[model samples]
Target: MAELWKSLPSWVRNIVVPVLVLVLAWNLVWFVVGVVSSLLGLLIKGLVVVGLAAAVVVLVKKAAKS
Candidate 1:
């Protein structure tokens, strides 16, 4: 790998490699952000469902007492 890199032209090593690295890093950052956003959305939905279920249970108990 070192030999292959060394064989590449200096221009490629300096310019092309850094550009590719930046592009890949940008994609990786967005990918992580998307995953976190999706997980958070799911978490919020789950919390809403749980809250609604609890509310229903409480209402039912209250009605039963009445």
Candidate 2:
């Protein structure tokens, strides 16, 4: 791999490689952000459902006691 790189022209080594790396990094970052946001949204939805269920249960218990 090092030999192949060394054989490439100076312009390719300096400019093209770095540009490709930057593009790859940018895509990787966006992919991570999308995955995390999706998981967080699911978690928030789950919490809301749990909270509503709990509230309903508490209200029903109070009404029964009265």
Candidate 3:
């Protein structure tokens, strides 16, 4: 394993390492933002559903009494 690592060209290793690191960092940040936005979207949908359900219930009760 050590010999294999040493055999790689120095310039190739240097350029590839930093590029890979930057790509990994960018992917991580993108993943976090996607997760947060997805959760926020779910929360907003839940609130809207709950609000609509409550409104329907209120309207039905009022209609029944009349």
Error of 3 at 45 (Å): 0.6
lDDT for model 2 comes to 1.00
* Residue ranges of candidate 3 with Cα displaced over 4 Å: 1-9
Residues 1-66, candidate 1, lDDT per residue (tens digit)? Answer: 999999999999999999999999999999999999999999999999999999999999999999
For residues 4-29, what per-residue lDDT tens digits would candidate 2 score against the true structure? 99999999999999999999999999
Q: Which scores greater on lDDT, model 1 or model 3?
A: 1
Clashes of each: 0, 0, 0
lDDT of each: 1.00, 1.00, 0.95
Task: Flag regions of model 2 displaced more than 4 Å.
Answer: none
The TM-score obtained by model 2 is 0.84
Q: Estimate each model's TM-score.
A: 0.92, 0.84, 0.79
For candidate 3, the lDDT comes to 0.95
Candidate 2 C-alpha error for residue 35, in Å: 1.4
The RMSD (Cα, Å) of candidate 3 is: 1.7
Candidate of highest TM-score: 1
